[model samples]
Target: MGLIAGIYSIENKAIDSGRHLDKMIQCQQHRCQGGEPVKYINKQIAIAMVNPLDSIFSEYDIPTNSHNPISGLYNGIYAFTDGIVLDVPKHKIYFESNGLPMQDNTCSSIVAAAYQKWGLDFMLHLEGEFSCAIWDEKKKRLVLARDPFGHKPIHYYSNNKKVYFSSEIKGILDAGVNPGIDLTSLSDFLSLNCIPYPATIFKNIFQVPPGSLVIINSLDIKIKKYWEPVISVDKTISFENAAQMITESLKEAVKRRMMAKDAFCFLSGGMDSSAIVSFMTEVSSSTVHAVSVGFEEEEENELEDAAVMAKHVGAKLHQVIAKPDSFFDMLDLMVFHHDTPFTDTSAYPTFYAGKLGSSLTDVILTGDGPDQTMGGSGHYVFAVKNNIFANRKKTFQFLSGIGAGIASALSIDPTPALFSKIHRKLYRQSLGPVHAAYDIRSYFPDIVKKYLCTKNLYDVHSAHNPYRHPEAWFKQAQGLDDINKYLYADMQFYVPDDLMIKVDRMCMAHGLETLSPFQDIKLAEIVNKLPGHYKILQTKNNQIITKYILQKVCENRFPEQILTKKKQGFGVPLEKWLKQNNGEKIKEILLDPGSLQRGYFKGKSIEKFVNVFLENKGDYFFPGPNAIAGLLTLELWHRRYLDFI
Candidate 1:
């Protein structure tokens, strides 16, 4: 919702140039489109903001506060807060808020009512999303914090003495910090679709994770988590009451998300999105605008469902028919925009869909978090049926089949062999104890970790949170399904940090704000208490899906065909794209010996992968690693950023 930028000298640089900082802050000016940028600079400290509060509010029944201008940045709207102050030499604090306060003088109020009581802990008590920074000049330190859910991102860089930080990565780069590509993050992207929190595609720079506050002092940098989802299982509620609570909570979550000045919804014709659009219509008096992207050759099932929902709710619908040519055209832009090697083929359409949405509104509401938070995929079914003792037996059988298939294929090439081997390893991990909540994450193999990353570094990264109580999550479950544990871990880690980060960054990249209704903390708390049956609802052929409660609340809102349709997820033709048109270019980037000198990947394995993909016997197109896509994306990123060729 806001941007922050500052540079502190380790050796007291005493430099006072705010122009670059202003340009950096201006990069996010779309976040404050209806207003202008506010800037302040002094020796050893600087700050820039896009908008200042209003000039008058008495007519609106909102209280007004007197403005104390810092070096002459006046309060405009007067009711809200936006402006930056840097009193570095004076050992004082400079602060601003975008649109949260009832009065201007209440900046003092945050100290008494919020900061003093909790100290840095005050971040948890905040209701709205914001990025805040304080320079303790006397202490020679800086403190930065983001809201608990990471609705905002803060980035920083330090060189022993001086520390520079900002809300956007581009801000730091504009400040003249070296913006080197972090191939480690690219590896993570290939493993997980998005960059993990605290690590961006940029080397040596990091984003502050959500629900976290970081302190940088003469001593060291420290980060602490203030909030996480805990298992609060209440088995007492009957199925009927649980259903009702979930229905009401979800409705309320959607209602709160509708408070934007302008809003649009991503429609996928699935239960989550359809339900969101339906409730949005029921709650709002305004006409809702819905946007969707579809393949020209894709089945019209989703489009029909989307059309039905739009008609049912009388929403203004806009569809972008995605032709193969369009994907090919935007390929470079998508790679450059992400600035990392992303393996998620769906990201292509998501980017185009976002482009379509940003053309209309500054805010877009999405249905990305619910599936993982609730029981959304085949993993949930596996969770339900998994038995630690019995599943291990099944695991051996599955592994044997995988092993036989790999061995009989008679390809000693380590790339495909390692690829298939790690998959079986994940399935083995998935079968572990039936209660390792981290299975959802561990589902992706650690090929890079095994051979690429060092034992010490990989151990540090793969080490599970010691605070996590796997037993507590498992004990809360009435049924001992492996899915519940997986869901618990996903909700705990992946939902807030990974999935939420992906949607937020993609939308914000185009200056579009995204509101995650499903990430409503209250709604997640309530749903966690529901019975297993209510969550799993009508498992068929061992597959589980969602929204049993939604049927009761608004049965007519979704089309019958959509309800019965198999889930055809958002996927891109990466292999098809590579093979049909750009295969040689992709293979060259990944298999090139010159590229191997980058040191993030094994050279030999990559060559084999390219060879096997060309032969079409690797089956690399599914839910596992597609080496060509990962390598091509990284090469594209390298070309655009590091090499600058």
Candidate 2:
């Protein structure tokens, strides 16, 4: 998808600083690294873009007749879109979108169609992973919109003098305003692994949140939500039908995604990836190459299972045996691309995977969204089971008995330490799922949070924390069950900001396009409306399963043993990395005099974190390796993007 940046200044303070807009665009050129796309500006309002059409073709091929940069027309109403529009020809109207020229629609077409038919109601028919900009000539108004799931992102900054918008934050910073770090967001980023919408790491610059749109003119500015995930717990379909529907819908989604001439699949050896590969192979006319990454340890790698699936699908398998130093070498580039403190250590593996996949093809499909969308997370399993007990401490103590039994039977750790960990895991959930996810998964512990932030840690969160009250997400879906409360909260932030952010940055770094079949709108609607329990189902034999329908999709294709495998995130050996000789680079960067001089985090607290990290004790200060990685990642990000300040 192409990137867009613009400046809209009121007539009284009008300025034609096209050079600044160009600089803004230059910062985000990596989003679509290949070709130069046209830009249009009028009456002090400017728009810059990398066309979505190049998402398919490396060359510029637009229909001659449909729409061109005809002089006066471009001046009045300018439009740009960052993702594909499927039904451009469905309306025969003059529309342009990100995809290759056909009947495909564009951000301009949608604006034109909306005025032609539904007036302001056009968003009801809008569908795609897109962020769009439209400037109105007659009204002197500008509009911005993002897709429901925010698959494509839109960010903007508004001051009394001007309003600036872009697909990334660098564009806003490029306007010569350089709003420094938003400390609140910096705190949240260290804790949540991302900064949520409307608040970027920088103040003033803001995200036009998902499912929302913004309109601006000389007199006023307005933003409204046009659509959201319709979470309904009402279901009439049988389990068999539900499973079949998920399988069929996903297959069709994957088929539609396979529109490219030479698309490949990212096979992680998990059920989601395996099922996607199976469907891709079923639909493709040629052999599909699947790419995967594995680590040195058996516990940290899944290459064996990946090999099994590659053979099952009769596809060529490309495996990268990853090590700590190789990942560390790319650390600075990773930090720059992320544009924020992205501490998901797995991003290292994804970065390498994308780099590897780019050599084979420009288009690849990934297995994302299943865990957050369908409740396939191991944490969810533990949370659901944990919520069952009134006295969680005692209940978990009992569960510890089961864990103890399993450990003893398997000749594993049956120590008191194991029991204590089992206790904390359950105790965290007893508070809430999102809370536990945040608190338990947080890199910086409360003790460390004190010094981790320059401001008082609690004072840093003067406003309510969304993690503590996940129920807020379910207010719209009042009939939604507990399982969905977590799902809805995660869908809103974690999946999009964290997982999807990683996918977007890593893939674009290599100039490749990634499609996820599981994130299909139709498929999401079918599953979201169903009872949340369907996400984690139980068989007659008392077997509990997460992503039940997804597991069913690849049952025949994946082996029986594969079904029992626990959920595994991309395997980045974080502890091993931090302990490596090269790993000392992380400590050097994090503990740099410039890093401490920022005075954002306390020196004493970081020193302690560094001590534990260097010793390689790795007991998970808050959650262990993530703490060290996150701190280092943030320091690197500051050094890369914000150090100039």
Candidate 3:
């Protein structure tokens, strides 16, 4: 793994690109701890990278083939890769079949050779999680590409004159791009709990969407999608056959990721992580090292289950307890690492899990992708059921109105203290299946956001629909079944933006490289095409099973308890923890004179909201612990990155 950053001057301005590149690299030194730093500079472009000691390519300089300098023959071609490229033997074979000469077996050389042969299409042939930056000196064009599933992240900022790109947002910030809040993106975050792709918290900075490339030239910058998930169902494939294929594919994925002699697996005792541990043991001759994190709260603790899974798999288990004592300290670090207003409470446990894993090994494996790809989330089941009711929208709306009228006539209040609960439910029921499904994942709806924010901030984003970003993806999944549509939208937006960002940043902060077997592009190509019912199965007895196919794959290998166990998601007890001393600290920061003067939120509304939640006087419809966490993180981010400056 490595960190890459660079600057491309469209006007070829007299600027010191190398100096900016140096600061970018220096800011993200944690990513390249004990690694080699390399840079290439010219009049129009400057490229810099830091490859970890264990990276596949030790040298990232320009291609050295004199006989066939590839594109360098025209002028000079430079390429830098961050993250792994799996299936090296197959890549070499493909290169040989295509009659492409390679200077060496390293990944950098392979990329250069492939670019020479296929030009821009070279990324389509690579099967791994990576972000690569290629500069064409001849054309004076700069290209940045990310892997299909976006396992690696690339954040870039561009003005009309120059473009700056990096593996992390902090890199670009250090490269002289002043940071400013994007209110629309902040609304997106407040509504959806995450800022979607192509839109980051910083006004001008954006992420290179997964399976896409950003091409910057002297004229303009353009983005092109190189790959995407295709949902062409094969109706003839039987359940047994599909399960077998998934099992084999997952095993192969695990085997491919076990390239390092010392690698550990994050075992959460959930099906995803448990399945990964099971496969890791089967692929490695040595005993697998498993890591887990739990909180003091019993409901949030999964260490016992993780230990049980580890023992069953014959792996050594390492466990860590996440405490409230270090909560604020950890939050400060998390906000710094995330580089945005992130509200994934699970990131707390993930951060500690990565820290524990990094203490043991550099490379760590996780079970991250299957939930979106294979329909593992319980929310999918709810979406399917909700869609059934949502189809009878006319009847539902009539009944809801009649019920409300009858309650009013009888002077009965269903939600006396929380009237918004009834309104929210009725509003959601009025939406179609796709919108309803989207609402299921949203923390705060747009209407509530209006009340939460100041008029200035609210009015600026009022014209923009919070659901606009996700709706576009849902529209793309038009003809698919309801479940598939939800899965497709989630795969396109949620996984890459929220889940992947959480895992990638938390782990990378400690210099740990994480690999997700379920994120295998090959596996997704096969699984994504399967019918939705195969993933969320309905039995004759009226029982719904989520991730049915995956359970079937693990039926014999995993213990019966493990296979039948309900999915306890990687969640932390935010409510319980927020009531602790840290809660008071959060209140102090969020309600501080400086914080209130920011004018992003209504002071009175926020004070009342925080007081109600912290005092446990809020009703069911009130903003929960997650929303409070969002506010705290946003304020902390401002202090750490923006306010500090």
Candidate 4:
């Protein structure tokens, strides 16, 4: 709904905190279109925010609570919020229970009151997509917290003398934090197509991890996690009961997110989005609007399915067609909005969908979280099957090692074909269940990336292994089954880093606000405790079904075609587009002298790789269209964020 930024001088430096805040807000003007910036400043700190025109409190006549980025001063605590608090009534009840009645029901007032009573533990009682900054005036202490699933983003930079935080990276950069590309994060992007949390492309700026708080004072800065997905199976809960609980939880979640006068949904015709639309119709008094995007390629288009779902739900559907010609025009803008190198090709269609939806309403609902939380992704099935195979570790490793040795003895030269056929088998067999699942999700395997990058770039990042991030997450799910372990890691790393970032940046580029009902903390608390088999059901005939419980909930309510249709994920025809004339432009930019001069990749290796992909001659070793897109976006990001700045 808005953006927040601020600076704190640890040494109490005599700087103009208000002027610096003005510069930071100016950098994020796109996110605050139609609203003025608000600021609270002192000698040691400055906090500022800008709410959108359609903010939740816009209709209120109260002087202090008329808009978001609302602030409150109570009991020596000052608080500011960028998004809504869904459960304000719950907080009010708690305050009354403690014999400390609230004077106002505004989000900032509630937050300030709660912090005054419970201190930092107050974050555990808040429920919504928000990022808040609270300053303890008496203690000279500042605390920043993000919502559980990171629906709102917060980035910060700290040093011995000063600390800076913002809702977006550009704000911090504009506040005079010199931007230097973090090579380790560059390696992460090349491997995962997105950088993991707490580390951004910029070395100095870092994100505050989701479901966590960052406390900075004159002494030190500390981060603490207040929430995480817990795995605890309920043995007595029947499948029917679980499905019923999911149905109710989903409806409640949708109802809570319906805070705006006019809200629409991003319907991909997939079960998740369709379910959201169905629930929206059930809960809303007004007609629901659904937005969908399709591609020129027949195989990639889902307009027909989307129309079918829209008719079934009795909602008006708005559709947009994404063409290759407009790809180049939106490329730089996308990169700039992301503030980093993000190459999820689906972002193209997502951007167009948001643009269409923004014309109708500022708030948009999406079906984003279930794939990771409810095991709806196809990769879950792949992980389960691979885990089963990997369970027989000794036998599989022995056989695969012999096969690799035989291929070596035959002088296969480890060519792309042979490596794809032989070495990958060895690689998979040698890894544990968690590692195997991670490998299956990687955009580029570590060995393949080594051949692609220059020795210097590769070696500089050698000590900073990107896989460590996922491995750490995997370790947290230690007691769970392999499937749950993989899912937990995805929830912790991939969902917030890649999927959420793509949706948030693409939609917010046009000043749109998005909410995901499936990401509800209560819903996840129920779903995460279910056994792995409940999520990925296996039939007597050995057939695999992903999200079985969700399907059961939708069995009678949704059409059979929608319930049974294979999940064609929200993606674009990047391969097809990359083969067109635009591919030549990509090739030229990647191989241009300016690009090669950066020294990220060896000139000869990159030249051959780009040629191989454009000529339709790619192999396992050669880069594919997705990898090429990553490289192209990286170059574009450099030109805009690094080069221009």
TM-score of each: 0.77, 0.86, 0.93, 0.94
Residues 262-356, model 2: lDDT tens digits: 76989888888988888888888899899998888778898988889889888889998777656665777887777777777788888878889
Off by over 4 Å in 4: 53-73, 89-105, 392-415, 619-621
Candidate 1 lDDT trough over 10 residues, lowest sum:
83-92
Highest TM-score model number: 4
Collision pairs in model 3: none
Query: Higher-TM-score candidate among 1 and 2?
Result: 2
For model 1, residues 373-445, the per-residue Cα lDDT tens digits are 6676655655556533233556665675576455435534334555455554454454445333233434133
Candidate 2: stretches off by over 4 Å: 11-13, 52-60, 63-76, 89-116, 296-298, 388-437, 445-448, 454-457, 462-471, 474-478, 538-543, 621-623
Rank by lDDT, highest first.
4, 3, 2, 1
Candidate 3 structure quality by residue, lDDT tens digits, 563-615: 87788899988787777874788688888989988988878777877777877
Cα-based lDDT at residue 570, candidate 3: 92
Ranking by TM-score: 4, 3, 2, 1
Candidate 3 positional error at 215, Å: 0.8
Error of 1 at 464 (Å): 12
